[model samples]
Target: MFYLAFFYPVYLGIFPNTFLNNHIIVIGIYGPLALFTTIIVFGVGFPILRSAYISLRDHRLTVDVLISLSAIVTYGYSITSLAFLGRQFLFFDVATTIIVIAIVSNQIRAKYKRRAVRELTGRLRNAETTVYRLTDEGETETIAAEECEEGDLFLVRPGEHIPLDGTIVDGQGTVNEALITGEARPQRKRPGDDVIGGSVAIDGAFEIQVGENATSTLDQLRDLVWNLQADQTNAERLTNRVISAYTVFVCGLAVVTFAAWLALGETGDSAFLTALTVLIIACPVSLSLVTPLAIGRGLSTAADRGIPILDQTVLERITDADTIVFDKTGTLTTGEMHVADVETSEAADEVLQRAAAVESRSSHPIAAAIRAHVTEPTQSTDFERHRYGVTATIDRETTAVGSPALLDELEWDCPPSIEESILHIRERGDLPTVVGWNGEATGVIALSDTPRKRWEDVVESLSAENRRIVMITGDDPRVAQQFEDHPAIDEVFADISPEGKEEIIQDLKKKGTVAMVGDGTNDAPALTAADLGVAMVSGSDFTVTVADALVTTDDLLPFVDLFEIARKTRRRLVENLTLAFLTPIIGLPLAAIGAVTPIVAAILMSAGTILVLANSYRPIMSQDSA
Candidate 1:
């Protein structure tokens, strides 16, 4: 529509049409001019006029009011010129060009935004795939992965994704967890090895015993990305403030230009033409758009790469972040536990068999680990359960398999050698299970959850920026010490309940901006309490919803990238506001002195708007490949 109105005059200048006719409202010869005039007045002018009317009715200042006032003045004056001044000073082209530039730039901006929305929706569709479930012995059924629940058995064939966060109860395979951990190497998994929901089984078939409910990690990631793409930040409110001030200034300058020209011995029409020039020159059409354009472009860039930011204030608030808090399980360290080391007074095999015999009856995660290592058939009597472990009779001997608290309760004494080994395991940030027979300590099984391959590097980079890294977890201090031991970590608060985590965040906020990173339902309260909540898409659904920045990828380094992008976004807004302000400053004074014409004012104003639109379209993430 803008193209037709913009280029119609060019066609008339070259072809020289003789279809000139006179209109009812004004006495003048009209040809293609009549059609072009109507298109410009209605196509672009209506929205401008409607917006200006709204601003006036609502008692607000807006850029649209400035554009509409300028367009109306030029248009009405041109009609009067055609009626009485011989059509020599008609400024119809100037009025139409104002709308043309706005329309073109706006259309281009909308197209890019639409493309980004499509891509994010595509990723959401791809994340949910079908899975195979175990129904009974040697029988399987196909089901959606989200329908599987805790303790349900599932099957994974070679090259298929592991359907849920579960233990490999049967078969063997090599799992590639690159997408979830950013580790390129494939890890071998046999019976008893834990497999993440999103990791792919590279070889062999396996039976996975699901640990929790069916919501897959991919589903969480897809939702977080979608939420962020739809949220717009405070940049828009800032734009409105700038536009309000600019509109008032422009209106005041145009009135001053009109009065000054009349005092310089100019006729009423000539003075008004000078005022028209000022209105066209001072209109801040571009100022209204700079905020959304730059911000939308940044958001679109993030979504295209599967990193969705679902908060309005995270990027801005993160600029001053001095404290970085991490949740221990599933955030800093993978939640899967492995038998790190084994110590036994008797043969290793005998101690494991006796422990497994007592643990096989329980469904606890630690029990599964012990059973994976050793299995035995024995009758149990006088069985009892405790919060930390279990005690029972095996082969007519009293057997205990649990924590040291369980050891102390039964009046069982650990040998000096076994006690030393238990202390050593605790110091290494590993979970230790004590096993004994006939009230005598036998062995200790140490289990540890490994940290991600990139955690150390990411932590070091964050610390280089003067960020204080803290880890808060429900795990015992002894179980969290390995992460706290890193040189990059500033503090560790361990053995915390969910409520305790929230309190720690509240305390940290007193010092400076705090960002809490976690990946579990238990972390939801803490995530909401922090100034900036960062969560992994692989975490619980509740945690994802409350988090400000959701890391769709496995790596935690995007927070750094987001901080930089936030800075750049601030810079972009300043650049746009500066550029928009410079146009009226240079053109308003010349129009007041009767030195600048209305056509020149339109040209200058359009040029400033185009420059801002162009700058806003630049991909912000390209600055650092964010």
Candidate 2:
């Protein structure tokens, strides 16, 4: 019906003597049909006009303003020419095509965003595991996983997922923690073993006690990813600003083109048509889409690989960073501390027992290592925790276990032999804690942590192209000696206090852009101080909250993946932006000179939008294939 009504005038021009060309036939049939078609098209395209009005009211301009102005000009001119001139010089098709194309382009962008969001939030929506809660009568009662609170006891049978982050209190089992740590091997779980919420128990049954903070790690990660997905990046903001200014310039140029053509003795209709063509050709649709489409793909790709970017701007910052600072403990090492050896003047077992008793009530990693080393736990009283260590009364005697500095603070006598042993332990890159009592230093316990698997490859990948790699830790300087000679490591700062870590990051920023990767609470200050802060999955909650990016695995290889993704995403943005500008640069001149018609300009605008969409999907498609 629309096509018949639109081409009725052409039909009449070709067959002037036909019965359909009569005055009454033209008024009752073609005129009303054409008017109805125009009304329908305008109604369907109301959103574009509304958006243009809102932007104008706010004292700003956008691509919508240009598209709306072009459509309105064509429609108004066609109506006036029909009413006053008694000639149907209609360009309603141009107006309808432009509005339809704009609507389609917006739908394409919305669909792309929806797909990306679905990919990120799918795991969260599917988390509905059932938990078996232990009742006060020692009977198990089934409950929804989210309903379980902290301090609640639950039973996890074989082949079942752990309902929440908690400690195993009764049973031993083998748990596959791949979902949390990215380690494929099954980890053995016994009493006091910490288990993540998403991990599955491979064998044996276990009664678990929820941690004080029983919120599921998976849930927290999902919420974080979801919240960050909507954040706009710096590149996106810059592009928006460019588009706004470009829209204003295009609108002004269209007006100038109209006046110049009329001044050159062209008719009003011809001059107005040229101005409308200019508006159609210079629409900034592609420019507005360049950064957001690329960023959406980049973030979705990162989330799929267990790396959630908490800030979309981190991608830009990470690519710009010249220096990468790593925290020693959980960032590069497994962070599972174990007592490798014990040295003492007195019996070794007796010293271990006394140290364990003193550290029993502390929740520090070193305390857990000491407690785990001694099988038969001894009781202690009058427990006191110092800044550097802990002291407790065991068997009516005060036993202290911590750094050598703790003994010096207490004015305890440190025998030369004990001091020499501590020095040797530090030289071997092992953590040394002094176990002293009776107003004298008795022994030193050397605890060791293994470097994370594939750490060397991660470091080498990140240290490419003269980029500097630095490691900082609170341990003794000698403990960091192991990394001092690493070819990829450019510097090592050891025995640095938490405040000192922040100072180091600030100082490094002066030399170049710095990115700090860490996992512990002490690293929180530094994480906040760096240009880009990345936190491991095992990091303290505070560190994760402050960091810009969170790697949802114990492995450091995500750092490599993240940097590569950022670089590729940035490159894609450049490619898309360049393609976006090329259309207007080449078409505007032809449009202003009356060589390009409104219909052809609309086609070119749509083609530009399609080109940007395809270019933005290149990295995402390649990532999927890989």
Candidate 3:
């Protein structure tokens, strides 16, 4: 539309009509002029008038007052200019050019903003599984979240989204609700248990009767995120208010410029042209757009890498986090246990066979590891179940491996050597399991696991950047100490329960930014209390929802990259803001002095916008390549 509108006149200018009396040419002249005039009137007058009306309605108009007065004065001079009407070619062309520039810049700004919105929204919308509703007639139907309605009954299988916030009407299961609570631990939800939408069921099945419609559930969350982002921050709000006030000042200046020319008896054309240049050059579009554009692109780049940044405030907080807190079990180390060592008194093969046989009935990772270690044939027995750990008769001796209290209750006697080994393993911060004969110690096994691969490097890198790393865990102090002595660690806390973690985060908040990284129920409070909270992607839905940031990949290295990305983003934002703020300061005086022609001001404005956009892309493209 813009291209056609702009080129038709050029075509006419170059090809002077061959037929003076031709009906087509006569109609085209009237049609084009009318269309152009209507567009200018609506585009220029409506916005200025509407803005004035809104300002009046709201009882505030420092900027709108200026714009309204400028538009009225310019329009009046434009109408009365004898030369402007006599030389319609130059007059219409100039006016059209200014209007076109304003319209086109606005369109470009909208396009970029939408592009940013699309990128971030896509990351937030990644859902792995869907809930299927079973109708009353015993038929299963899969429905998108938007199609779900209140009071609808939905069935969530072992691996499925909860679909909406509701209570379990008749079934029970353990749900990974990290999205809501930031708790990595799977919560066992029975009948009447409240479930939130987007939470995954890690284990067990649930039949949830939906209470809230999809719009009220997921859509509401999406809206909350959008509103939080759209609502300007303190700095942005102040900047906009100042910009608005500046715009009003410019309008007043335009009025003064026009009145001064009029008093000097200058032609209406000259006065109008000067005032128009002032108004166009003074538009705050570039200044108003600086922060949003830079931050928007930064978020888009991060989202492209599959990192879900739930809260935008985390970006700044994370970059400045001097002290990093990590929960030992799931945040740093792999939550899964592994078989580290095995020991026994009898032949190694016989001891392995006995241990595997006894452990086959257990679901613990250690038990699974023992079962994987040995291959042998043994008589299957219905292990006599006890209140403590399960018991079984092996040959003539009963054996069991469980809590120390369980073993003590069974009155199982073990050798001093085995007892000493257990103490040794515990002192070294290894999780240990014991195996013994009916009344005598026979063997003991030890397992040790630490932070994820490259985790130490991540900590070292942060420290190299002058960040202090701290390890916080619910495990015994011995376990926490194991990581504290690690070269990267600056502090350590052990046996710190959920409440303790929250308290530590609160204490840290008194000084500066605090970030808690974890993946369990115990970590939820700390995650919420900290300045910024990060959780593993695989953690419970409750945990993820409460967490400000989430590291989806198992590798911790990406988080380091995230910190770099954030810092780079902040740098770009600063650059954009500086450019935006400086352009008008430099250009407005030139426009007033008539040193900057209207065309020149428009060109400068466009150049400023392009520079702002180009600057926003710099950090993103660099990080992508790096």
User: In what order do the candidates fall by lDDT, top score first?
Assistant: 2, 1, 3
What is candidate 3's lDDT per residue for 334-423, written digit by digit as tens?
Answer: 766666766666665665566666654443345556666766624323344333344556786776654333457578776777777777
* Top candidate, metric TM-score: 2
* Candidate 2 local lDDT, 16-36, one digit each (tens): 546444678568754775586
Error of 1 at 273 (Å): 1.3
Error of 1 at 235 (Å): 3.1
* Model 2: residues with Cα > 4 Å off, grouped in runs: 1-50, 75-93, 111-224, 229-231, 344-368, 371-387, 390-401, 409-411, 436-443, 520-522, 538-543, 620-626
Q: What is the lDDT of every predicted structure here? A: 0.71, 0.76, 0.63
Positional deviation of 337 in candidate 3, in angstroms?
Answer: 2.8
Show model 3 residue runs off by greater than 4 Å. Answer: 1-31, 40-56, 59-126, 129-163, 168-228, 263-269, 339-424, 427-429, 432-450, 520-522, 538-543, 621-626
lDDT of 1 at 334: 65
User: lDDT, candidate 3, residue 617?
Assistant: 56
Evaluated at residue 323, the lDDT of candidate 2 is 96
